[model samples]
Target: MDSLATTLLSTNLPPTDLQRDSVRQLILNYQKDVLDLRSQYRGRTSPLDVMARREHALQSIAAWKVVLSPVRRLPFEILGEIFVFCVVPSLRSRSTSADDPREPPILMSHVCALWRNVALNTPRLWSDLIFLFSKSLPKRGTVPILEDLIHPSTPHALRTYIDSGAFSVSDAPDILQQLIAIPEFASRVQTLHLKMGTRHLEDLLYDPPPVFLHLETLRLDICIGRRQEFVGRILKFLDSPTLRRLTIRCTYWEDAFCISLAPHFPWAQLVNLDLDVELKAAELVRILTQCVNLRQCGLFSLPDHKPRRYFEICTLPTLETLVIKGWEHTYWLFEIFRFPNLTLLDLVLGKWPTEALQVTPTFTLTHLALHCTYDDTEDGLALVLRFLAQSPMIESLQLNDIHGIGLIEGLTYAPSDNPVLLPRLEILWISIASWGDAAETVLRDGGEGLVQMIESRLHPDLRPSCAPAFAELWEFGFKCWKPKFSVSVQERLANLEEDGVLTWWE
Candidate 1:
C-alpha cells in the first residue's frame, strides 16, 4: 500500500517544460491530491515533502477549476493591413521568371492556416497572381482550382495574371472563357497581364468580357507564331478608351512592332506607353507623333541604322520623361527635333552617334541621364559638352555604364575654342560598372592635373548657387546587366551637382 503511495507521488520531470493541457493537468493534480493523503496516512513522506504536499492540497480545488483557458478571438483587421505592405513590389524593379526557374508568391498562402485565410480573404492580395503550369492536370482537374480562386464569391477586387504557354492554347480558350464568365469580377479587374509565348492568345480572347472596359492597364508579352494576326487581334481588343497604360513586348525585333494608329490611339487621352519592338528612325519618329498625351515611355533596345534618317526628325512634344534602352551614341549626331516639355530623360545607350540633339526650349531639360557604353568617355563627354554648349541650361545629370570626365586622357577639357560649362549644373553623378583602365589611365596620365585645370577654368568662386552640389550618387543596373554605380565630384568634378545620393535636388 505504502509502495503504491510512493509510486503515485513520484514525479520525474523532464528538463524541458511541457505545454499544459487543461484536461490532463486537472487529472494529474487530482491524482497528486489523492496520493498526498495516502502518503500522509502511511507516514511515508518527510517534513519537507509533507509541506510541499500541503501546498498542493490547498491549491488543488481552485487549480482544477474551469477558469484556466485560452480566450479564442480573431486577429485584428490591422493585422491584415500589415500583410498588404509586406508584398509591395519595388516600383522600379521587377525580376523576370518567365524563362528562368524562379518561385512565385502563391506559396505564401500555404505558409499557415491563419495566413492562408487572411491572404485568401484579402482579395487584393491574390490580385498579383503569377503561376506557371509546368505539369499536366487531371482530366477532371485544373478547372476546379482556378474556378474556386476566382469565383463570383471571391472578393471582387481580384486582378488577373494568366500565363499559359504555347501548348496551352486549347486549354486557354476554356480558361479565359471561364474567367470572362465571372460577371461582377470582370469589371473589378484593373490590370490584366497576359503573356503566352509561342501560343496565339488572341483566339482565346474571342469573347472578352466587359471587364476590359474597366481595365486601365494591359500587358501582352508574346513570341507569336503569327505576328500579324496576333497584333491585329490585340489591336482589335484594345477598344478600351479608358486604357491608359499599355505595354506590349513581341518576340520580333523592336521595329517589327512599330506604331500603327486606329485614329483613337492619340485621343489626347493616353498617358503612358511602353514598346519593346523592332524600330528604325522613320518608324520610331512617326510613332512618337501619335502619343500626344504620353507622359512616360520606355523604349527597349532598337536596331542601329546609319545616315541618321529616322530619329533626326522625331518629336516628343508632350513627353515629360523618356527611357530608351539602346545604342544612344549611334543616334544621329545631328540634333534633337523637339522635347518641348520634357524634364526627365533616361537614355540607355545602345549604338552611338545615331541621332543628334536638336536644341529646343533648352533650359527645360532639368533631369538628364547618359547611360552609355563608349570607353572614349572623353569623346562622348566632348560630344555632350558640345551638345550642352548648344543648350547651356541642364539642371542635373546622371551617367551610368560610362567612364567619368575624359578631361584627363591628356586631352583638353572642352577645347578652348569658346568652351561651354554648365552654368546651372547643380547635380552630377557618374556611374561605371567595369572598373578598368578608366581609373588607371587617369592616374597614370595626370588625370588629377587635368581635373584641376578644368575646375580652375569653370567659375572658381562658384558657391552652392541656390542649388545642391554633389547631391547624390550610387549604383543602378538591371537583370544580368553588369552591376554599375559610383559617385565622385570630389577631386574630379566638384562645384558640380545637387544634394542627394543617387538622387538630385531640383
Candidate 2:
C-alpha cells in the first residue's frame, strides 16, 4: 500500500486502468480487514485505549481518502469560479469587516490551504468593500488588515458602500481619506453608495475633485441640511462620464433646490434616475424634459400645487417605468406630459383623481399599481374602470387601500354580448384596509367577487365560446385588514394554489 501510494503521488498523468484497479482492490481489502477485526471484537469487551486507536485509524483513513476526490483535480480557475458564485451579490456590500467569518470571502479562506490561496488571489472575491464609520471610529489597525486581504495587483472593479451613521467628517476624517487613498481604489469603483451628510460630502469634494473612471451607479443619502450652493457643488463634483444610474435622497425637503440643481446632472446620458426631493408640477416637467435617455425614473413626492404658467407638453419617449409616491393633483401630471412608450405606472396617491383618468392618453401599459390613502369612491371606481378599459394590453394590476366591490363586480366576466376588460391580465393583487362595519361588508363581498373573477379567468370552459383566447391568470393575491373569507372559499382557493394553477397569497 505504501509503495502504491508513492507511485500514484509521483505521476502527473492520469492513472492507467491497472493502477485504478489496484487502488480499488486495495480499498476493498482494507474494508474486509476492518470487518474481520470488528467481528473478532464483537462479544469481547475491548480496552478504551484500543477502541480509541481503532476509531482514530478509521477517521484518518477517511480523511486521507478525501484527498483522492475528483474535485481535488479541478484547476484553480474553475475552483475560484465556484467560490465566486457562493458570494451573494446582494450581501456583497454588507461585509463590514475583513474578519467577518460569516461572509463568503472570509469563510472560504478558512476552509483549507488551497481554498485560502485561491480566495486571496481571486480579485472578485474581495472587490466589494463596505465601511461603517461611527462615533467611535474604526480601530487604527482595521484599514491595514483590509488592505492585506484585497489583492494588490487585481484589476477587478469594486463596489463600495460607506455609511457614516451619526458621524461627521470632524469625528473621523482620516478613515474615509485612508480608504480612498488605497492604491487604485477610487478609479476602480464601479458602484458607490454613500449615506453621509452634506458636511462629509463637502469634505470629500476637495480642490481637484475625486475622479471615478468606472463608476456606473451612485446613490447619495444626505441626512442633514446644508446651503443650496453646497448641494449644487456636490452634484457637480460627483458627475462622471461613465455614470448611468443615480439616486439622490435628501432627508430635509428641498423642492426648490432640486429644481435649480437639476440641470447640473448629465441628464441626457443617464439611463435611470431617482430623486427623493419633492417637486411641483412645473418642476417635474422641467426635469423630465432634460432626461432624454432615461428609461426608469422615480419621484418621491409630488405636491398638490398647480403649475404657475402654461408649458409645452413634455414627452418622454424612452421612459418605460415611472414611480411617484405621495402624489396629489394627478390631473396636473397627465395634462402636462405624455408617456408614449411607458409600460409601467406606479402611483401612491393622497387622493384619487377622477379627472386625470379622463385626460390620460391611451397607453400600452403592461403593469399598473395604484395605492390610495383615502377610501375608494364610486366615481373613482368608475373612472378607474374606464381607464383600464382603454388599456387592453395590461398584464398585471395592483390596487391597495381600496374597498370597491363594484370594481370587482365590473371585472367579473359577463355572459351577455359585451367586450371583455383586460383580456390579457395575468396577475391581480388587491389589498383592502377594512375598518368599520360597512368596510367589512364591502371586503366580504369583494372577496367573493375576486374568487369568481379569478375562476372565470382560470377555467377556459366557463368562458363564452365567442370570447378571445385570453391569457390565464397566473397569480392572485388578496389582502384585508380583517380576515373575512368563508371556509369553503378558503378551501377552494387553497386547492387551486396547491395544484399550482395560480399563486394565492393573503
Candidate 2's C-alpha lDDT?
A: 0.63
Candidate 2's displacement at residue 249, Å, is: 1.5
Residues 39-100 of candidate 1: C-alpha lDDT, one tens digit per residue: 77567645676666666765654443322322112353554566666763532233422112
**Model 1 alpha-carbon miss at residue 57, Å:** 18
TM-score of each: 0.63, 0.76
> Against the correct fold, how does model 1 do in TM-score?
0.63
lDDT of 2 by residue, 285-321 (tens): 7777888889888877665765889888778889887
Clashes of 1: 52
> Candidate 1, which ten residues in sequence have the lowest lDDT sum?
477-486
